[model samples]
Target: MAVNGRSRVPTRRDLAEEELMLDTYRGRRYCKQHPSQQMIPLGVADVCPLEHSAAGEQPVDQ
Candidate 1:
């Protein structure tokens, strides 16, 4: 089977392994390191404005 750019033969073991991995994060939103925040599926590099702020800290008014 060709998915994206990778080709692999679908097997019971492969499906099982993929399911197991998905199960580990079935309901997860954010990453393990930032459990309180929402998951940024694409990435966080220069995309999240508050990425550098401390959790729960309010922004300073200009």
Candidate 2:
């Protein structure tokens, strides 16, 4: 989740995370901007990637 303010530095893996609104990874199709490009801010959801998927729970959970 997006904190009211910036607190920590984001990693390449964190940025590459696709679901969150603040994902600014270079690998993402939308954020053509470089990861280091500070013009835009970034954030991640508190939820996990599998939880966000329409496929529902992880296959291992069954």
Candidate 3:
């Protein structure tokens, strides 16, 4: 399983687990972290982006 443009982030310890991701009709992220033997839509290791800015943090670099 390979993510086209999304790359893995570096970490101190190995995260020997896989997480699945799903999107609704409006393209919303849904986490389905299961270890079943089926096709899954994995997302970036980092947490999802916020809908709006609160404290004017730097925008994420896509």
Candidate 4:
């Protein structure tokens, strides 16, 4: 299934794949512009210049 063009909540198999990917980047940070890039050292934050607008939708479980 799809949610807003992205995949829905991951299943157990999907989570296992993600875990393997995470292990490969055990000591690196992800680049916001390109999530596949993990060249930054761990604990360093990416500086995003764009400002994100707040979502107008209210919480569903409220």
Candidate 5:
């Protein structure tokens, strides 16, 4: 997903794993890292802005 004409942040390794796991179960799986956010569909890997910040990576332009 683009924000303010900027490209989306690349998915981190851990997030990619979680996303894949969630995709396997679809609606049955819950995002353990972000329980409050809406379920991320198969290809929409745009959640968790803080995931990058917490890892010491530079924050993407939102």
Candidate 6:
């Protein structure tokens, strides 16, 4: 079981983080433009940066 009874299904970001051996917060993806910032995954959902800002909180129950 995952937090709030949600499944821990791995997103693209999660896989990318695992591939990079990064321990970033859940739902956060790597940012190529701003290496320091981890934004939400978008586009093909392939874990690439779409924006260069901090990844806002995921939608409720997302």
1-62 in candidate 5: lDDT tens per residue? 56799977666985787778866865443445555545434565644432534554454333
TM-score, ranked from best to worst:
4, 1, 6, 5, 2, 3
lDDT for model 4 comes to 0.53
Candidate 2: minimum summed lDDT over ten consecutive residues — where?
29-38
TM-score of each candidate structure, all chains considered together: 0.30, 0.21, 0.14, 0.32, 0.25, 0.26
**lDDT per residue (tens digit) for residues 6-34 in model 3:** 77774534333222122333244332232
The C-alpha local distance difference test score for the whole of candidate 5 amounts to: 0.55
Candidate 4's residue-wise lDDT over 11-52, tens digit each? 899888877886786634554444454543335554333332
Candidate 1 lDDT by residue in tens digits, 14-48: 89887688669754355344445555445433123
| lDDT (C-alpha, whole model) for all candidates | 0.55, 0.39, 0.36, 0.53, 0.55, 0.54
Q: Which ten residues in a row have the lowest lDDT in candidate 5?
A: 46-55
Q: Write the per-residue lDDT of candidate 6 for residues 1-62, one digit (tens) a residue.
A: 26788888888987876856644444446555555556655554645344434554332221
Give me candidate 6's TM-score against the actual structure: 0.26
For model 6, the stretches where C-alpha displacement exceeds 4 angstroms are: 22-62
Native-to-model Cα distance after best TM-score fit, residue 9 in candidate 2, in Å: 0.6
Tens-digit lDDT track of model 2 for 1-62: 35567577767777756436444444333222232223332454222222223453423231
Higher-scoring candidate on TM-score, 1 or 3: 1
In model 2, which runs have C-alpha deviations exceeding 4 angstroms?
1-6, 19-62
Indicate whether candidate 2 or candidate 5 has the larger TM-score.
Answer: 5
Shift of residue 52 alpha carbon in model 3, Å: 25
Looking at model 1, residue 20 earns an lDDT score of 80
Ranking by lDDT: 5, 1, 6, 4, 2, 3
Better of 2 and 6 by lDDT: 6
